[model samples]
Target: MSEKPEPVDYTYTPIGTIHSPFKDIVGMPIQPTGARGIRGTIEIRSDLKGGLADLERFSRIILLYSLHRCTGYSLKVSPFLDPTPHGIFATRSPKRPNAIGFSIVRLVGIDDCTLTIEDVDILDGTPLLDIKPYVPAFDSYPDERSGWLGAVAHNAQHAKSDDRFQ
Candidate 1:
């Protein structure tokens, strides 16, 4: 048998901070669909202001941020839409091995280092890790299956987060 490779650690610096209306995890929308029209702002670091160039061209942007408040992780979790415990990788549980989460929000406008965004489901004061322009042709999959989520995915539009993940 082949030997397993050694694990390596990496470091990341926050490029900015995400500000949202939801301060607490309780009662906050679980997904962007539920947080539709909710406005928020991203305060990019002054040093990274130059990176914002031509980013506003996209109508939507994918935000990868750190789940700062999530303490620990579980291999299985009962997500907001369903109470059945599923593999953490199968669900978008904030409690992950890396405590990282991502959201695709509508880009409203950008001024210097600040970006006005809508359909935000993230918590306030979340550390912004990275941002990528959303391209439908590349991100959308018309024939893709969502496995277990297909049954309860519709409820996401109304589902709200509880203290379970915390």
Candidate 2:
């Protein structure tokens, strides 16, 4: 029998902050795809600004951010789009052990360490953990199956966030 390795604890300091018009969670779009053309800004810390070099080459970027406003968590949750309950890992619900939110947004422009972005779904003043350039070849999977989401995927286009996840 193999011994399981004990998990080590770690912490992450936000490399930047995301600024958006959605000050409150009541009416925000639930996902990037649903928030098409919504303009927002990301302010990278001055020390991390150097990492922004060449990021502009990509038309989009993936943002890993902390759901700072969302508190507490439930292992099983009813996501914003679906009424049925699902395991926290099964849905992209913000209520989780880590409270991390992943969003991909269009990179419109860059000014020093600040970035102009579109298709944003995160809340204003959210703490950003990291950014990665989106590449279709690597990130896109046209034929992938979406499991339970496949049935209600269309709802995403018209769904707006509410206080359910808060």
Candidate 3:
């Protein structure tokens, strides 16, 4: 008989919580692109101040966080922009086993331990995991295949949040 693999558990305490104008789940922007110009603040705990050293040098940063507002998961889901179903990993749709979200937001400023950001699509109070500078020289690609997303290029700028992930 084959033995089942043991479950590995890892824990992370949030360094801070996000504060955004979007309180309700409905009618919010589904992606950062759709949420352009929106603003939010990341309230980092004072103890984490040392970790943020030199963060202000970057113009934009990537935010890895938890989608705490989403309650369930599906192996497959229809994204806000498409009618066809897609594999969970292939789409940026928020429904997942871990409910983790990733976004690249403009760093307007950093005061003390708080970071004021723009292009905020994340929910208020979302648990922030990590932050990294968005370096276009290393991160941007002028030509790349978008897979299923290529079928609906127009939706990227227009899709708004829906309750499908709830």
- Better model by lDDT, 1 or 2? 1
How much RMSD separates candidate 3 from the native structure? Answer: 1.7
lDDT, candidate 3, residue 130?
86
Among all windows of 10 consecutive residues in model 2, the one with the lowest summed lDDT is 150-159
Query: Model 2: which residue pairs collide?
Result: none
lDDT of 2 by residue, 71-159 (tens): 99999999877789999999999988889899989999999989999999989999999999999999999799988999988888779
RMSD of each: 0.8, 1.1, 1.7
Task: List candidate 2 segments past 4 Å from native.
Answer: 2-4
lDDT of 3 by residue, 1-94 (tens): 9999999888888879999998888888888888899999999999989999999999999999988888788888998888889899888888
Runs of candidate 3 with Cα error greater than 4 angstroms are: 1-4
Q: Each prediction's Cα lDDT score?
A: 0.95, 0.92, 0.89
Give the TM-score ranking, best first: 1, 2, 3
Q: Provide TM-scores for the models.
A: 0.98, 0.95, 0.93
For candidate 2, the C-alpha RMSD (Å) to the true structure equals 1.1
Model 1: residues with Cα > 4 Å off, grouped in runs = none
Tell me which residue pairs clash in candidate 3. Answer: none
